[model samples]
Structure formats: C-alpha cells, structure tokens
Target: MSSKDYYPMETKGSPKSYSPHKNGNLMDKSSSEQTEKFLPVIEPGLDSLNKNPEDVDFIPVDHTPPDRYRLVFFIMVVHGIGILMPWNMLINAKQYFEEYKLGKNETEVVELKGKFMFYLGIFSQVPNFVMSGINTFCQCGGQASPRRIIISISIMIVVFITTVILAMVDSSDWSVEFFWITMMTAVILNMATGVYQNSTFGLAAILPMKYTNAIVLGTNFSGVFIAVINIICIISAPDPRTQAIYYFVCAIAVLLIAFDAYFLLPLTKFYQHHRAMVRRQQNTSGPSRSFQETCALFGQVLKKIWVQALCVWFIFFVTLTIFPGIWSNVTKKDFPIENKYWTAIFCFLSFNVFAFLGNIVSEWKKIPGPRFVWIPVLLRGLFIPFFLFCRFEVENKVRTFPILIDNDYVYIVGGVLLAFTSGYYSSLTMMYGPKLVEPEVAGIAGMIMAFCLVMGITTGVNFSLAVASMAIQ
Candidate 1:
C-alpha cells in the first residue's frame, strides 16, 4: 500500500481527518493532503541529511504532546516528597523520642538515650537498603506498576497512624517498652518507604529527565519542610508529646494527598503518552520479563551506568556521614544565640533551604557534565573533615584535636556549600544514570542508581558512628 492509502487525507468534506500518533498526538491530515511532512527525531551525531540515518526514525512533529499545566511533573514531585516523608517525620521529631519517651530517669537517659538514635539509624537504613535491593529486581521482573507504590504508601500511613496514637498515650511508666515499640514502628515505616521510593525513581526514569530531577527537588523540599516545622516548634515551645502528635499527623496528611495525586497520573495525557513510547521502544505489549531476561538486562544496564551510580553513592555517603549525626551536635553556646536556635537555623534550616535551592540550580545548569561529575562527588569528602574540625560537642569526651574552624560564620558558610553540592550533584548524577542506558531498560537503570543511593546512606549513617567516636575519645 502507498503512504497515501495508509494515511489518507480529508477531501474538503464534512470534518477534518486526524490520525493519532503512537505517542497519542493528533496529526491534522487536511494541512498535508498534497505532501507528507517529516522531522528529524534523532540526535545529530552520525550523518546530516543522509539517505539513512543511523538507527533513527523520523516522525511528524505533531507526535510530541505538551505537559498540560505541568500536572505530571507536579505529581511526580509530590510523590518525591512522599518518598522521604516517613524518614523525615521520624528524624525531625527526635526530641520526642530521646527526651520524652526514653528519658524518664537518669538511668534510662544513660542507657536508652544514645542507643535510641543509634538503633533508629540502624533499623531505618538496614531494612530500607535491603528492601530497595529486593524491590529493584522484583520490579525489573515485570511487577513494576502503581499498585506497589499505592500499597507501600498505605502501609506507611498505617504505621504513622499507630505512631500518632502512641505519641498521645503516655509511656513514661514503661519507658523501656516504649523504646522497643518505637523501634518497631521505625522498622515498619522504613520498609514500606523503601519500596515506595525505588518505584518512584523507576517510574520517573521512563519519563523525561526533568521529571527525575523533579523527584530530587521534591525530596530536598521534604527536608526543607521538616526543618522549617522544627524551627516553628522550637519557637512555639510545644510539649514533646504535642509536637510528636502533630508531626505524625502532618505526615499522614501528606501521604493522603500523594495518594490522591497518584490516581490522577493515569488521566494525564502527557504521562500516558511517554509511557506508551517506552513500551513501543521496548517492543513489548506489556510489562513482562522472565527472571533470566531481567538478570541479563540488569547486567547490561549496570555496565552502562556504573560510573554514574558511583557518583550518586559517594555524594550521599559524604552527606549522611556528617549531617545530623555530627553537625547537629556542634554547639555555639559561647555565642549570643541559643544553642537550639543555632542548630535549628544553621544546621537544619540552612542545610535544607540551601539544598532545595541547589536542586533548583541543577535543573537550570548541569556544570562539569555527567562524565566528570565524579570529581565534585569525590571532593565532597572534604565536608567530613570540614564539619569535624568545627566545634562539635562530643558527649562526655574532651576533644584531643583543637577546633580549627571555630568561626561560626565560616562554619555556616561551609554547611551551605555542603548542602548545595549535595542537592546539585545528586540531581545531576541521578538524572544522568537513566539516560546512559537504552529506553527499554532505563527504568531498571534508575532502580540500580536508587539502590546504590540507599547503600550510600546506610553505610554513611553507620560510618558516622565511627567518625563520632574517633573525633574525640
């Protein structure tokens, strides 16, 4: 059949003819009745205006659909925020656990106080990392869908609801029991969140790269929200119980909103169109893969994007190593500012705000490019020592090493740089990972990067314990 026979035009009749592109766009046949229109849909690399472009196909320009109101982008951002909500809520309300629930007596304080934070870190990261690895391969084996995302969020909602109830009930009489119960909640919450987070990165990878960056922005924005809330709680001086209740309830509300946003994803033409393109690229009618096929694809994707994976891993490793664990303890009691406000404003608030801004900057400019992004990622190791040499209040141990960066202003500036680079390089490396591989397995590539990201956080959090120990005595 001729091209005209397959793609016939309207003959100035009742209504204009239209054909839907594979990407769900409508092509107007009346305008091109006499001649066919084609555009170069491939990247310019091999040959220009050649008879046959290398592994490229040309389609009408109308095949591309616009992201209406940027709804899909915004929804992905919301999911991004939801991904980190559980962890942020737990950490932001540290005082409620450390002081109110676990610090009923001197003995409790001496025994359970340090262990609470330590165990919290371990339980949260360990399950999260393991589940992320498990979920990554599971998704690669054709179980990738919004159902898992919804189910994971539902589990977290239930866990947070239980936490809210526990926060309201007084646990002072049974502080030790309360500590174990709280640890159980942390374990359950992180497991669900791990699946939720990896699925989000995988879904976003199939879309445009900016959508992936949007998730990074949302994650950082989650931190900014919690930090701001923390400052407000400090100023209002809410009781620990009251603050904990509000924090858990607010997290529930965010999850509910995200739950609603996800239902809207299928209705968005932009999302559906790109999703269809990914299917067509892979030459698959459905998400189906044998275990052996998934294993082979995983190997191929890892081979292509391993460098970017390392970059993402090292970036977060440096970040989690010094953050909250070390930086949160650095006190400025000698200055006029209250030690609480200093940590709130400089450490929590500044890091989050600058980090969010850094995510924004990364979207606009990708300096150093993907190939050399590792240079900056490695250089972030300096932050470990930079914060270490500052005035950190090591518990019950005198510092053998003198504080070199004693100036408060200098320390704050260093924190700003640290936070900004964490956000910027993180976005760059994550966005780069999926793009390095072919479209069919790009989602798998994103999952590998996410798994590595979790691995980085897990190792860094545990490593911070060592750094804290050696910093003084």
Candidate 2:
C-alpha cells in the first residue's frame, strides 16, 4: 500500500489502508491504545501550567540562582535590627519608670509596673489591630506589588520614628494623658512594623522554604542585639533622666535602621525578583489555585495550625512579660549592687548571647527533632515556677551567700532559659507551621501568631496584677 493510504493502528494489530483525502485522515490502530494508557492521568488546569508531555514549550524550572545566600543574610539583619530597638526599649521602660518615681520594694514597684504594662498592652494593640487588618486585606487581595509593599513599609518606619521622637520630646512634661497618648503612638508604630513583617513573610512563603531558617535566625539575633544595647544603656545611665537619654540614643539606632531600609530596599531588588520568579515557577508547575482559592486554602491551614502556635505564644509572653517585671523590681529593691543596672544589663545581654547560640545550633543541626526546641522551652517553663518559688527567698531579706550574687544568679539563670526557649520556639514554630499550611497563607499565619503573642502579653499582665493584689490582701 502507498504510505499516504496506510492507516495508523488503533490497536496493536495489522495496518489498514484508508484514503487521507476522501475517507478522512488515516487512524493509527495502535495510537488509541497509547492514548488509552494516558487517559487516566488528567492534566492540571491552565493556571497550574502542568503541560502535556507532547507540548514542546514546557521548560524545566530554573532553581539555580545567580547571587549567593548573601541577600538572605542581609535581609535577615535588617529585620533583626528593626525589631531589636523596640523590644529592648519596652523591656527597659520599667526600670526607667521606677527610677523616675523613686519607688522602693518589690511589692510596691512591681504592682505599679504591672499596672502600667497591662494598660500599655491594651492601649498599644490598637495600632496592631489596624495594621493586622490592613495586612490581612493586602495579602488576600493579591495586591502585594513591590511598589505598594515598599511604600507600606516606609510609612511604617516613619510612624515608628515619629512616635519615638514625640515620646522623647514630651518626656520632660509627661502626664497620665500624655503617657496614654505616647503608649498609643508606640503601639501603632509597632503595628506598622507588624504590617511590614507580615508582608515580608508572605513574600517569603512563596519562595523556596530554605530561606525561612535565615529569617528565623535573623529575628533571634535581633533580640540578642536589643538585649545587649539595653544593657549598655542601663550601665551608662546614672539616673532616670539619663536612662531616658540613653533610650533616645537607642532611638538613633532605630533611625539608622530606617536609613538602612531606605538604601537597601532598591539594591535588594534582585533578591525580591528571585523570590517572585521562584514563586511563579512553583505556581506554574506544581498546582493550580486562584488567588481567592489560595486565600481560602490558607484560612483552613490557619484554623488547623494556629492552636499550637497560640499556645506557644501564650506561654512565651507569660514568662517573657511577667518575669522581667518581677526580676527588675526585685533586683533594684533588695540587691543594691554598686551597679545594679550593669548587673541587670549584663544579665539581659548574657540572655541574648545564649539565645543567639541556640539559634546557631538550630540552624547548624537542621534537624526536625521537636525535642531540640521543646526541651529548652519546657526547661524555661520549669524555670518560671522555680523563680516564683525563689521570690520568697529574696522577699525574706535573708543573706544567703551574698545578696547581689544570689540575685544575679537567679536573674541570669532565668534570663538564659527564657532567651533560649524564645529562640527555639520561634524557629520551630515558623518551620513547622508552613509544612501544614498553604504557602500563600503563611503571612496571615504569622500575623495570627503575632496576635496571639500580644494577647498573651495582655493576659499575663492582668494575671500578674490579680495575683499581686491577692497577695496584698
């Protein structure tokens, strides 16, 4: 038979002859079987870009990057510095307030501090809630364009700087109303920071998962630096007024961070570009889901995973907020070391150092062992109860060993455990939560966790006050 008249096999059988022009095109007898072989395998939707094997346009994803992981490190550092100043300032604020008032004794001092912090927690959340709402909208709407993101971040930084300056300027003539206003401003600024943080995390979620570790490590180190700088401020300040001055100096550090962000944002476009590219590749080759669909997927993920993250956040803030207040008051009241401020400062710095080390170990080990993180956290939880027990030993005013040494040891031990657990928990939570969530929703997941943290702080302070009041009665 002529080649033009030869028909393709529909089954693996003898060839038949058919006229291409008159009897329609020649059918492949074997081709139907071949087609049947692949009939059960469905091609993913166009949005997913899972091309058929016959398609020639399909290209394997390019995972190789031109730049090294240096950008990851740089971004992480920027993130860390941004958070460090705020956290340290908040932690040290109690000491400054106490010095200003000339308060004596743990009971009197801690009560006042606890009340102030409780109010601060409630007041400060206003900005955070606003920021979170805005962030939730932006992430869901798929409006996270670079221009929009950068502008949002810049506004947040400006708010932070402006609020800090206002607080500093008004410090000399501070009143309760002014204090409330300052706290409100600080909270909004912090909320703005949270917005930027969520945006960044959303951007990260779409990229390869390895960069998450870098972010986690960077945040931990930022906490460390904040602690170290706070210690220096405590050591150098001779009086409450001077301590306020040091805080202003730390504000300068924040100003520097703002400047860094300004300059670095443009230069870091490559990193951003790389992330976008990878995300697109994943979206194209992996699965098909619309923006709305992705958001819905993320919501489900949040509902499932947030419970554990919330628990972690609650435990963290309880120990973090309450104990620091108690430790500062107790140290200042009973242990009048020649430089108690320095002792406090060093203890905080040492705590950060231990936290930094913990992060390094976590990064180096790269193990998914839950115990690696949980054991340290559990130990810290245990340490909290221990500290509560020892509160009486210090309260009795007994000279067991030297007063300063005893106080120092207690603070150091507690601080170290707290720092270690905080670093470990943050790392593990970020790492594990994503595994169980849709990548698109990781930003909101983080936001929810942040919300839990603030809530925890609020509850912990309230609990502390209630306990203190009960003890007095």
Candidate 3:
C-alpha cells in the first residue's frame, strides 16, 4: 500500500479520502480534520532570546526528583546515627582508659594500653580512607543499582551485628589479650563498615547541591539526637548492661537502613537502566564518552578549582585533628562536675548544639557574607589556647559539700567558642566541598575530604599523646 493511503494526515477543507482496496470504506475527513487541528504556536522574539536564554522556550529537565530528596535525607539520618556512635565512645574515652589502667601493674603496660587505643583509632581509619577512595571511584552520575544497594545494606547489617557481638563478649571479665583482640575486631568491623558509610556520604554530596544545607543541618541534628540518647542510656542504666541497649538500638537502626536501601534499590536501578539506554543511543548516533573520559574531564575541572578544594581539605583536617585532643584533655581534666557520664553528655550536647546553631546562622539571610563560615574555625583556634591555660582547683574534702566551686570562666567561654567553631566548620565543609567539585565527581571529592579528615585524626591522636606525656613528666 502507498504510505499516504496507510497513514493519512487530515487538513482543513479536505474532502473525504479512501483506501478501499485495504479498508473497504472511505474515512470521515471532516471529523479527522477537526480532531487533528493544530493549536496556535508561540515563538520567542529575537529580543527575548538576546535578553536571556531562560526567556526562550525549552523543555524543563529535573535532574533531581522529589523522591531523591527523601532518599538523601533518610540516608543522611541513618549514616549520621552510625557516625555519631563513635562520638559517644570518644566521649567515654576517659572512663575506658581508667578501666584499662586498673588491671595493668606497670606504668609501661598502662601506657601501652593507651597507645593501643590510639593506634586502634589510626587502624580503624585505614578502612575509612580506603572506602572513601572506592566510593569516589564508584559513585557518579546518580548511578547505583538496586542489587548494589542491597549488598551495601547487607554489609552494614553484618558489621553492626559483629560490633554488637564483640561488645557483648568483651563486657565479661576476660583476659587482657582477649579483650584487646575483641576490641580490635570491633574496630575492624567498624572500619569495614566505613566503606559503606563513606560511600553514603559521597553519594549525599553528589546529590542536589541545593539540598546540601538541609542534609548538613539534618546530619548535625541527628548526631546530636543520637548523642543525647546515648547519654541518657549510659547515665540512667546501672552498669555495663546499658551497652546492650545501645547495641539493640543500633540493630534497629540497621534494620531501618536495610529497609531504606531496599526501597532505594529500584530507583537506583531505574536510573542506571535509563543511563545505559541513553548511552547506547548516543553510541549509535554519535561519539560516546567512556566513564574514564568522564572522570578525566571531571579531574580537569577540579584542577582548575584546586585552591578551594585544598582549602576545604586543610581546614577540615585541622579542625578534626585539633578537636579530638581538646575533647580528650577537657573531658579528662577540666569538667567541673564529678560524674564522668554527665560530663560526657554535657560535652556532646554542647558540641552538637553549637554545630546545629552554626548551620542555622549560616543559612540566615541577614548574615549576607561568608564570615559566618569562618567564625567556627577562628573560634576553635582561639579556644585551644584557653583550654591549655585555664584551670580550676578543688579543695575542702572534710565537709560533705565543698566550701567553694572554683569555675574557669575562660575555659567555659573557650568551650562554647570551640563548640560554635565545630558547628560552623561542619556546615562549611558540606557547603564548600560541593561548590569546589563538579556534581559528577562530588563523591570522589568528598572521599578525598574524608581521607584528609582521617589523616588529621591520626596526627591529632599522636600530638595529644605526646603533649599529655610531656606534661606528666
């Protein structure tokens, strides 16, 4: 049959047409003509095109959908909870150290135990750094499959379970070697889990940059929430049993994470499938870019913006490195209150509160400048000195209550400033890193930032130990 006879286009004032040889009847041309009428077309004027590209008519492309926002937020919350678990452990370092010292006879042994804990932090960071690097390589162009998501979630679950089991096993009165081994095992599990955790962070960074402010705010808030919950449990519970409760909560968190992973898997698979289809079409019709080429292009773009990226890495490294030592010293010596648990809670609360507030102020319209971003870092530098110099003396052991409660106003002011600085830096890191890197390589950039942070932590631990030892002598 003729092409025109098989598929006819109706026009105004056209008479009835027929393909009797095939259809056996003439078609109603008037009805078809009315049904296929074209509407008025609006064309952009030359002035409009010259004024702005936005004024020209074009199809809207939403790279990030609403569901992706929910996914990002949920992932942030889950990962925030996981990340904050270490904060509680760090806050309780003094108690853990004291317990370690109680069993050891020689000063050398005690020091060795302390060194082991420090090394544990360093070793744990190895997996973290590796994971960060891997995440940077894998995460790109919003491509993650549902099966991959499931596998990631399963790994996290297994890690959390392993951590809980180790914690439980270590709680019993056990040999020092066994205790250390179990603790190391837990650290290993945590470090391995670091791969998935850091991957999530990389993903979060690459997702819509506009949502970054919200993600930071959410992560900070969630971290605080986890810390507070940990504080309450540790304080109220009579003994080591509370650790079990912590594990149970963590298990629930893992389950929630698994559910989230399962839900996101389909969406990620859909995105990957769509990307493959587009890539295939391009390959057939035009020159197609390989993933390596895309990565190289991203590297070139980052090379041009290296200054901001390096600044972000350096600032975060400094902040993370210095803050841990400050926490260790402050929690060990300066806290006025007698209850160590209470002190830990107070420190965590203060730090998180300041961080959350810093994020809020950064978003404030009245601020109008990047000064708010620097406030936290500058405040942190100032606080370190105050923490070093300020001191409070305790006397009057005879009476039930002390005659006077000596307070270090300088230290308190410094602590507040430090907290504010931490908050500010946390917000800025999330904000500035994405700004420095292209969206496609945001994951890699975030991983690099995490590597810098881990290095800082490693150096900070050594510095703290050296300074503390020297002071003791």
Q: Please give the CA lDDT of all the candidate structures.
A: 0.77, 0.49, 0.46
RMSD per prediction, one decimal? Answer: 9.6, 11.8, 14.4
Question: Which digits, one per residue and each the tens of the lDDT, describe model 3 over residues 203-305?
Answer: 4555554344554565467556656665666667635445444744555574465456434532443233322222222222223335765466446545644
Expressed as tens digits, the lDDT of each residue in 170-269 for candidate 1 is 8878888888887888888889988888888988888888999999999999989988888788778668788788788889999998998877876666
The weakest ten consecutive residues by lDDT in model 1 span 44-53
Please give each candidate's TM-score.
0.85, 0.67, 0.66
Measured by lDDT, the strongest candidate is 1
Clashing pairs in 3: 355-423, 376-421
- In model 2, the number of clashes is 9
TM-score of 3: 0.66
Q: Runs in model 1 with CA error above 4 Å?
A: 1-62, 140-143, 284-289
List the candidates ranked by lDDT, beginning with the highest: 1, 2, 3
lDDT of 2 at 246: 62
User: Distance (Å) between predicted and true CA of 462, model 1?
Assistant: 0.9
Per-residue accuracy of model 2 over 128-231 as CA lDDT, tens digit each: 54564566555432423333345544555565566455545534344444456656666765675556555555545444444555565665566566666566
